[model samples]
Target: MKYQFFWITVLLIFSLSACKSIQEKANDQFLSGQYQYAINSYSQILENEPDNLEANQAVAESYRLSNRVEQAGPYYEKLVEEEPTFENVYRLGLSLKAQQKPAEAKAAFEKAKGYTQNETYLAETQRQIEAINLSEGIEDYFPNYELVNYTELNTAGADYAPVISENFMYFTSGRRASGIYPADGSPYTKLFRTRAEGLRVDVGNIQTLPEFQNEEGLNQAAIAISPDGNTIIYARGNSTSPKDLPETALFASYFRGAGFTQPIWLPVNEDETWWNSTPAFSPDGEELYFASNRPGGFGGIDLYKATKLANGDFGNAVNLGPNVNTPGNELFPRMTADGKFFFSSDGHPGYGKLDLFVAEKGADGNQVIKNLGENFNSPSDDFGIFFSNYPKEGFISSNREGGAGDDDIYFFEDKTPKPKIVNVLLNVFTKQRVAGEPDAVLEQARVVLYDSSNDQEGGDFSNSNGRVRFTLEPNADFTIIASKGGYFSKSIPYTTRGKTPNPEDLIQEVTNITLDTTIVLDQLILDKSIVLENIYYDLDKADIRPDAAVELDKLVQILKDNPSIKIELSSHTDDRSSDEYNQDLSQRRAQSAVDYIVSQGISADRLVAKGYGESQLIIENATTEEEHQTNRRTEFKVIEIQE
Candidate 1:
């Protein structure tokens, strides 16, 4: 027994020693910023101890830092299922969303929502859910862009973020001849410049900048040029050696005849440890845009704008605010020469990780951010965008399926042939219902149009001709409400489905298509009973049926539309049951209906329930069932008009 015990103890000791060795190595690699090596080292520990929380967390973070969050889903799921902590679950949701599993991601986010008291985390969770909803069916709309991979400019490594100034195009590429980076297992990246005409570039002429900017043992990428092509800034750092401290920040250089000046680290990066990259200059060169993960940001990384101070220095970096930044990373911000702003974000709710979007001035002059939709965004990382024209042509970078490298540059043009616009105008005529005569035009009636989502589109008062007109967009559903003083309001549903002329069919540059409709409002008359149809109770029962509830909802709407009107709800019975019993049952039914209306937000003080049993039957002597049904009825009429 002693010999057997000794052998088992030796084996156990060997296994534990191996696991400790691997754990120590992984921790070393993780702290030194070699996440890929750390991932492999930590994974070995997981093979022996799958529930090792430290190993699991490091491995998942490694994948995210390497820009492969799509592959971190399984590890994140394991972490969340084991711990169910807010951070774990929230990260799991992001991983799932990066994997294009939005539904599962949304559920994970909702679960994480219940576990946090942090306002920022809670707001981020809700934003993620909204993003999932906003991204649903995002591709089923009109597509306007046509993209082409610039094959001559690509290599087997990543080649992305192209910017043009004067006659040269500058970009970052991983084709630099060097040892592979341990983080992503790719060669070190450097900024390269080449002669180019729009989408056509001379790859043979490509060359790196001075050795100062393309320093050894660092990854220099994401280059941008100033409007005059005299100033250049690029993101640099992320040491290739474990002995060096790791960082990513912006560095700038200015033109000096044949060669540029020695690259100087920009002062806009106030914190060295905070991650700042993707620098861009505004068209006027008065403002600089970049992405950072500094403190007080709403997300993992946010876009910031820094204004140029006097004497040619930049400072006072300001976050783009919540309108343009969300709970996820926002990167690669750029502006066009024509004043249109664009950027890439994972927070804005789009096709997948890092989709392209644009921010513009709305009708109210507020910032309006809109997704570029499926045309420019894909189910993969699509970012590093620049536009040569205002809204027509641009170049974008992505790692989508057909790309030649990790992230390839593609030229895109708005090839949606400019369509002959057809104006769709809806004119509404408001008329009053006159007793025993044709309806008369009603002036000064309020008409409002709402879209399918119940958002008000337009509103106007009827003019001297009793007409209200609204311009309609193509393929929309609308609700038109007409209201006038001392009259019952009315709502009409309108649709323009299948009514738009196809672009191919339109010949004129502009076409006017007009449609007309009429709305008739009833003049309120006191004590005139309006029968509430389809409100029937079971025989001898006083409970309100589901059908009766449906009819009462109409009365509830009427009460809401005319706030100053009060009504009396009456119930009647046939001359079949005993007078006393019939009176009690009828009164109960009327009260049940009144209770239902009250439940729908109508005030009880504005309603009165009355029962007229066999004492006041509509049919004095009912013989057939139809006559009984007519006699046994419920109705409501205006009793008091406070207006």
Candidate 2:
């Protein structure tokens, strides 16, 4: 009787194991975001039962959810062709659209639209068709920019999430020689530091941070440094599962005398139920922002900020609300010094995958979201934007094509941005000074504005009345030069510096300003020296002043425009000082001006520096203060014009 019972128990155990269905196993993996595993399970079921509708549908969905929508297309096409159900047809069209086959996707959507009885779904299908048609010819949204891939900091594996502190940049990378993690079968990510000098990053000093490593397994990669550079916060996982969907929490470390202390998990983490990562500190260093899948959030992962207490512990975390968080993930939350918040989301209408976005208050005190556009975002993942005190230039992490690794860091500069404006006009004109008549218009002269910082030049010839109207960017500086044949070039220093509205207003409101100005050029006469205006120095010093830089820039442009022209930069001083001292001071001032021009990329061999002290005063026997001021000036004489 005992032997029979033991055999019966063994048979019952085997039966129970075989009774577990493939659909149940696939469902478990699908819910856990292990789509690859789910795909394998469903594909196994379809191999034995090819026409199993449930298995085929699950297999297609697994491919779509895993960002392998191209692999789902064949399955969806076959299912729709055989079943022709409204749901199947609609899904087939979506799969085609994800592969960028808009025409075919539209045909599938139209076919599905005819079969759907639900009015809401039919309307949604029609909207998708219109959107696809519009996107077929969509223009790039952001201004032209230069993106520099930091190849020096990238490796054959993944590298991303960059944060700058002082002269060093801290980021995450899977470049270690240690073998791939058992989970995910990819190189484990660790914290790395290297020197970042503007856009020229160096990899020679790339070092894996020891204090932030996970000895037992792979640690989290996303990290944030404090404003004072003394503390760091990062994410860490508790499990070493192959799915890599371990329970994660945030941890903090302090920079002690020579190295960082052991990391300590923060108190804000839930009791092993939530997954947390991507920690960022506010510019003020008072709030810590991170992404969490905690309950009570708006569905998917939501961004939360916790206030720092006086005792160094975090307070209760607060949700960022719906303006920024969405039904999809709101990850990599970063704040610029100006209080503009940026994050990444897939729930928003984007070019598939994740896209970067900025959230701010509009003029009406409501939230406004702005997409960074294709220049900074791609169909692949783009997130983790970090600004260096200012927002004009910064670094971003992307998994776009042609990268050195899975996710590489890129630097961008908006040097000559066409800022959003409202009704600002630039009136270009030429002045013809006459003793008795109003300054007559000198038409047909060329008016050019050059931003030397960016090497961007734009201009137009004067109209019939010598007036060419246009607009310009605010809070920028430019050199406006007016020139014509037989005319000595005239340079006007222009600045669009004005008090900008609040951040919210700047995002939505436009300022109106009408600038009415005149540019004058004199007829060139041989051997005549023209005094460069606003060229001044300190009372007894020879250093070039800020005012002098503006004037010297114009001389640099002149040498560039007339490439073959040679000139002499001369400086003069008043007779108040001793003759010897005056001569020495003026010589230093002339050389300083010449050096400034040379720094602007002009050839040193094409110019000469001369000091004609009080000996060659403009106002001889000067007695009045105004006369002495006139003698203290700088001028450039055209020595030779090869043309």
Candidate 3:
């Protein structure tokens, strides 16, 4: 028995040693930028100990560093709830943004601002929060661009940078030989061509380019053909070591009579690479545009212009100036035949690290940069746009979730969204219902408006004319409450679903129509019996009817809205039964109503049930059946007003 126990201890020690060794390996991989391998190792640990904070965080960071933010969201969500450090919270916000959850992402970023004292981090967090806000309502300005995709072309690898020319599509894909790049775990990219018709590509014929263009052990991609299709350019490079920066540069090949020439680096890069890439040619082929991270630039990667010489070489490069550059990256500069300039930027106010933007001439003739908005951009890397057909059809690339790969090519078309020119406005009036006179405008009455979700949208006090106007969204339901001192609060519903004017019927750019509603509040007089409408009871029983319960619900809302006021709910009966029997029935009916209200989350102390019996009647001697039926009614009177 002693020998067996000693063997068990020895086995336990070996198991623990193996576990520790694996954990150390995962940590090493994470530190060395082998995020994919780290992710797999940490995931194995998490399978046994799901709540391990270190393992969860390692997995989350692995996915994030690998540029798969959508995959990191669940882990970060759990980690934020478990251990909300600044990094976890900030990364969680990024994950939320990648999932297109702007509101929640903004909230997380706002919260993260409080956990850090570093000014740069705080500034970035605030900027992202403002970007989320700025992104709202921008889509309304541009025509909706619809993206279409085919299933057969997209693979588990990154496929992007599509350019169409002469009935063929040239793009880039990282699906080569299952070789992995530790930084992102994607294979080396290669340029590929396929038969195409406008926006559609024939995936079955897709094949890699000749060996000269697709050199082994290196990443080469993009064949951004010029407007004339005679010149083709692409980005080529990859890091040889993990500790070194990637050696990306722009390489071009000219289309001679029958075939292409050997590719070489553009002279503008000086043949010494420092992140120069994503080359584009102007419509007239006079100016070549490219993004570079060379020294003496406005930002990390600025768009630069170089004039094409007569000898077919690009001359000295000039930065596109601050108007088109920032402290962050600006890449994938694409120009349309009509002189419209479009690109992707991480420096602008956008939903994420990179967003598609267009530079348009303003009314003052100055350049105006505008984000393409949510319809054309996601909270992911969206770039490499090509105008296969300008303003009508084009192509873009994105790493957004739901794509078939890390990055996928998409076809976009100008759908020309319908003009939303109908303006919906509401003019609400608060009035006092006089006993014997017309409704009198109740000035200074407080009016609060709530949406269908019961969330308060806006509030105002009635003006001198007892009118309050609210801007309502199209096709929405709202509840308005009007209340004043010495008056009972009233609630009214207004819907603009079918009542709104047809947008097409409007002649001007925007047509404004005002909807009118009134909330008639009754005077809150003591001992005044305010009859509840349609309060019915079972024959000879005190049981509340379904219809009666419906009416009672309105009273419940009033009680909740005016918490300081208490009321006495009383029931009346006609002089058909004896006084004792009538009193019993009336008391039971009144008590049933009070019980019903209490069941609906109302305080019991606010309600008092009273049996009026046949003592109080609207008609002292009812000779007609209609008058007798009126005598048997339920009413509530204001008994007490508490502070």
lDDT of 3 by residue, 1-643 (tens): 9999999999999999989988998999898777888988888899999999999998998897666776799899889889888889998988887677888999999999888999978987886777778777566325667887545788888898888778888888987643676666678788888888877778888888752457766677756677787788888776556443346788888888878888877777774648888888888878888889998887778998899888988888999888888766899898777667899997777867688898888999999889888877777888988877777787889887789977898888888765967777899988899988999999999999999999999999999999999988878899898888998887888888997777776668777878898888888888898999899887899887898999999999888778889899999999998999999999999999999999999999999999999989889889888998899999999899987
Q: TM-scores of all models?
A: 0.62, 0.55, 0.56
The alpha-carbon lDDT assigned to residue 481 of candidate 3 equals 87
Candidate 3 clash pair list: none
In model 3, the worst 10-residue window by lDDT is 238-247
Q: List the residue pairs that clash in candidate 2.
A: 183-242
Angstrom error of the Cα, residue 293, model 2: value is: 2.2
Q: Per TM-score, what order, best first?
A: 1, 3, 2
TM-score of 3: 0.56
lDDT of 1 by residue, 350-410 (tens): 9889999888888998888888888788889999988766566768899988888688989
Clashes of 2: 1
Off by over 4 Å in 1: 1-19, 117-119, 137-142, 210-213, 240-246, 418-643
TM accuracy, model 1: 0.62
